[model samples]
Target: MRLSLLDRSRTRSGYPEADALHHSVERAAHAEALGYHRFWGAEHHAVPGIASGSPAVLLAAVGARTSRIRLGSGGVMLPHHQPLVVAEQFLMLEALHPSRVDLGLGRTLGFTEQVRRALRQQTDDVDTFASDLEELRSYLRREAPVTARPVTQTVPSLFQLATGEGLVTAARLGLPAVIGGPVLHSPELGEAVAAYRRDFRASAETPQPQIIISLDLYLAETEEQARELALSEAWAMARSRETGEFSPLEPVEQIREQHWSPRTTSRIEKSLHRMIGGPAGIVVPAVERLLEITRAEELMVSTSTYDRDALAQMDAAVADLLT
Candidate 1:
């Protein structure tokens, strides 16, 4: 039972990057010492809600700072970038980190079709996404059956990052994948696990099913404090449902400032059910419940604390669970 962290690069109510990066680098350094096995950062472009815009740059910097913990994208949405460019950049990263790098590919543009058009991609994007993923896989295998220009032979291992059917494809392709969704709820949990395991194909790259799942977190000193953090994440989750993905941490005061009809609050609770409370006594049990339900290979908890004080408390609670 390994416990890892996912840094979604939340803006923390518009915290300065100069400060956040300094804190993140220092925090990741501490995470390495604290025995966290892997630290996954994320990427977002044109989203003021998240600060994790340049995942590659951040990982490289974090890679330089620490030597042991594995690092990579919690996911780089495949539809947004050229597969060739991704292969080359990751190849370079592999040259630097070797076995320490992990690539999780999501099929999203990470936004809407309107934004997809904004990114200059076409309607055929999702249709071509799978093939593009295969191209990236073929390049990494360093053995494309055909002689193709723009081959990727640098990275030794590349894993697919997906949820739903993409998880099944990752199995068929025999790549390690992390299975999850923009949200985690419902009995779809068992089906998702079964889908990945049932259709697993033995390929030259991998012979067994390898998987991971995201745990929406709120570990803190007191249950009340935990609920407060959950409130912030819940707010983000509600916004994502309306706006497409997780937004920055809103000032709870500001959120309270808005007159939410009872309808909105009920809608949010129905969606983000698992993202409540702290680890003081409940963290381990919530995780155990998740594991009992999903039995994922790894657990990546998502936290939405506003500042270092909250992060430190959450980190310690998580550390206690790890020990």
Candidate 2:
């Protein structure tokens, strides 16, 4: 039952950088004090609102301030950067923090179509993930000797098995596995977990498959608040998913005005149908049920919302659970 922070570093339109950074640092500190097990980030490109373009750099700053919590990416969208450069950066981070880095990888393009084209990462970008991931693993094995750049002084060799092909390999390779895109009742997700379990093997370096799942967690004081928050978050996701449009956090009125028809609501409900409840409504109970289902070694909760109160309530729910 470890808790962590998952943020896109969203800010209000026309906000100052220093002001937003101050709030983000404070939120990070607050989550730390609340006994969360980790603080992780996501990667988004050309998103005007999300300030978290550099997850590794932000994690380093976060790691410098926190003594106990683990710092890592919920995912570094793999197609954007050279895997060798990423591996080197993360290797340096591992050198700095020693046994405290987590690298979650993903193949999905995290940028808009225009930006993707600009970055030369189109639909044909699958090979980048495969090649880069392989190269990174090679670099981490430290067998192919190369001129090592100055290491970041941490030795966290906890490589994340991030691909669909590699979730099963996590068992064989003894690296931890993380799988998202879990539609609660989907047999597809079940098959994925089953595949991973079947391929799981024990090695001298690591004996067990550490599986982590990301779920949209709604935790608030009441169900109404939870729904409101979830709607806001869901709307934000819907906007991102529907249009390539990204912007600063819209005001409540503006967000509410974003058209929602039954069809779109159904789509959203289908997208997040697995998660929708308050802390008392389902945070612990839902997590407990998910654990019983996936039996994952860990659960990484991602609460997507532009509302600061909703964000803070996530920390609050974790606090209440601990209390």
Candidate 3:
């Protein structure tokens, strides 16, 4: 089992966003030292809780700090930026880091109308996602419709962060993909992975179908402690859905002390159930089942916690299980 990590550089209550950003670079170096295969960062805009606004810049920081592990975006939302700018940013990353960069792309819009206006992005941008991806690919291959400078054949491996029709698009384009969250725990997973493999076409870059499952994972010595470790993020998720704003991760004790409505309680419980937690006995079997169903080539865990030390401990434990 190949194991990797997806760090969103989540901002916590008492810490500065700068710390979250620096922690991402530090975590990538730690992951490399721990023998993890890849370390992927995320891109989020207008989301105060997450500090990773630019995947290219964040990845450059990680790339400079780490040598062995593969570095890339969990995804850069394609709808938000120009294809050429995206290409140049990542190409510069590849140029600096050599063969260790991965260009993970996705089609997602801004979280709010205000954010949409800020990015000059609209919901209709999704309709052009496939065409946009092709344009980016063409630029990388030096076959663009318009001439561009810094012509080089060097390109990073492409991976799509997708589900449903997006998964099929990735297959048609012959790119590996990452999918998980609620879908991994649902019946739709088997069909989704199967369809991705069945409809896949080989391209010169990626010759075979490859799927990587990404999930929320929390592991601790006891189920109680593990659940506690997960509460901050779980509460944040519930609050974000119920309210318009996504707040920073709170302390476990603080979360427990809050008065929650039935709706928020249910949302928190649902978030908890979606995550894989507890001891090796519980977590290992769940991971095994996920692997059996998806038959994915790799697994990536997106973990959030207030305590960096506990997070690192959980990561090391999960890494041991993968071995």
Q: Largest TM-score belongs to which candidate?
A: 3
The model with the greater lDDT, 2 or 3, is 3
Q: Tens-digit lDDT track for model 1 on 1-323?
A: 77677777667666674555566666677778878878887876666567666677788888899998888787777777877667767766777887787787777564566666777877654467678888877767665654334333445455677655677778778877775555246567777767777888877767888767776677767776666666666777676766576666776677778766576687567545666465446767776777776667787765656656667667766777755
Leading candidate by lDDT: 3
The residue-by-residue lDDT of candidate 3 on 1-323, one tens digit each, is 78899999999899887899988888888889889888998888989899888989999999889888998888999888899998888888888888898988987778888998899976664388899898998888888886444555567888999766788899889989898666677788888888889999998888989989999888788888889999989999899987888888898888878999999999999988889899988988998898998888899989989888998888888888776
The runs of at least 3 residues in candidate 3 whose Cα sits more than 4 Å from the true structure, single-residue gaps closed, are 124-126, 146-153
TM-score, per-candidate, Cα-based = 0.87, 0.85, 0.97
Off by over 4 Å in 2: 13-22, 125-131, 152-154, 159-166, 183-185, 203-205, 279-281
lDDT of each: 0.70, 0.67, 0.87
Off by over 4 Å in 1: 17-20, 123-126, 145-156, 239-247
Minimal lDDT window, size 10, model 2: 147-156
Better of 1 and 3 by TM-score: 3
Score residue 85 of candidate 2 by CA lDDT. 76
Output candidate 2 Cα RMSD. 2.9
